[model samples]
Target: MVDLMEHAGANPGRGTYGMAMAASRTVFEARRDCAALLGVKDPRDLFFVSGCTEACNLMLKGLLQPGDRVVVSSMEHNAVTRPLHVLSGRGVRVDFVTADTAGLVDAEAFERAVAEAPTRAIVCQHASNVTGTIQPIGDLADIAHAAGALMLVDGAQGAGHLDVDVAALDVDAYACSGHKALLGPQGIGVLYLRSGLDAMQLVEGGTGASGADEPGQPLDRPERYEAGTPNTPGIAGLGAAARYQSAHGAGIRATERRLTVRLREALSAMDDVVLLGPAPHDESVPVVSFTSPRAEPDRIAFELDRRFGIAVRSGLHCAPWAHRTIGTLDTGALRIGIGHGTTDADIDALLAGLDEVLA
Candidate 1:
């Protein structure tokens, strides 16, 4: 990754020189690795963007027009909800399937929402950012297909952690942050678009094509969406990260799951602590969120960081709807994000710090 960043500094997809070709290859390798990481069949099916926010915007704004409806889960992050809100002001009908207290969306309710009207797409997050509770995307995708609507997923929390095979899920589109769970650098993301499906151009600029004679952006596969110079170095780092995940993902998954169970067991034992989200099980990711009536969320987070040097996030986790679903909207939550580098010792340290904070 460092070597590629140091050497492949030229602009990708625009130059004819050797250095330019090298940069292009660097970017393509990133795309290819990320594609494999997500079980994407064709590398061209994905597009690089600033982050999942942009991907969400592209999926909502680019695809749905006025009066076109989209069904979404109430547990979605602001990235998906805010865009739909903006579109709603523009006459787009956005229907929501409210999740139960356990942060699980009901498939029958979702199907009922879809059946109420002509839905252009069914958009949802693959998992809750606050709770790490994985949604039943496969079941929802089936509902969308039965209604002849596209199934789009916000994979920011579930991309590298869960089963993300686009074919098996029949997902028409997926947007995710590479930095979150894919172990990639920040400012990089992928938007997976099924072949033959189309989203309006997110941006319009030089596609590194021969000429700009054609009016409007070219309606080609990837060129239709990807525009301007991409972050070559970031792509290189992401490619390396993707390759690393591919090689050691199973082991990493097991470790994360074990640590998550450890955290859940320890936290649930405490009298003052109230755990949020679905019950710990095999069908979940490693995000654990909790709250204590004895301590404020920020103070707990501060004590844990200052005393134990253990980092955890406190607040809404950028998904108030999720917090609401789990009955943590007003007080927010303290989220422990167990990642690739997290170990038993780290979880132990967190639990110990939490004990002190709540005590």
Candidate 2:
């Protein structure tokens, strides 16, 4: 990725020079490889953007129309909900399938929400960013299919941690970040739109190719949605990250699961500590959120970073709906994320640091 950033310096597309061709080839290959990470058959169906937030915006705003009715989960991040909120004011009817206290959105709730018929789309996160509870994506997809609504999954948290085969999940659209668990440079994202879904082109600008052929943007898979020059370095990095995950994703997930159990068990043992989401031993991503009556979430996170050189997140994690669903709207919670580089020693250090901070 760094090499590409340094060498593939020329702008891609509509160029026949050596560096220009190299840059275009880099992006083309990156798109092909990254699409495979999401199990997309055609590489052209995937588009690159700044990050997951942009991808979410494109997916929501470009897909639905004035009279469309969309069903989303209560645990969705502001990325999904905020766009829907804006669309709602314009004529889109937005309905929520509220999650339980465990931050789990059941397919039954989804079925109830979509039962009214004529639903246009069913949108939800693949996993709760705040709680790490994996949502029943396959089951929800089945329900969405039954209702004849398109299934859209926000794959931000679940992309690198789980086997996010968009084909297997049978989702119409998927958006995910390239950083975080994917071990790529930030500021890049992937949006996979199933072929034949004629979503409105939200961002229209120069697409490098065929700019002179037509007055409007090219009516194609990626060029239609992607505007202007893309983040070549970031896309290159994301492609490398996805390729690495494809090789060792299973083992990486197993390691994270074990670390999750270790962290959750220790947190559960402490008095006054309230763990959120699934039980310590349940199936989930390697994310744990907790709050204690005796300490504020912010203070805990601050102390851990300042005193012990440990890092974690506090507050609602940009997912206020999830916090509300999990009964942590007021106090929020401390989130400890176990990632690819995190190790057994790191978990031990975090637990020991928490004990000292509490003391």
Please provide, for model 2 over 190-285, each residue's C-alpha lDDT reduced to its tens digit, 9 standing for 90 to 100: 899999998887788888876556887788778888888888888888888888988888899999999998888888899878999999998899
What are the clash counts of all predictions, listed in order?
0, 0
- Can you give the TM-score per candidate against the true fold? 0.97, 0.98
Model 1 per-residue lDDT at 74: 92
lDDT winner: 2
In angstroms, give how far residue 168 of model 1 lies from its true place. Answer: 1.1
lDDT of 1 by residue, 219-263 (tens): 876777888888777778788888988998888888888888888
Cα RMSD (Å) per model?
A: 1.2, 1.1
Q: What do the candidate models score in CA lDDT, each in turn? A: 0.86, 0.89
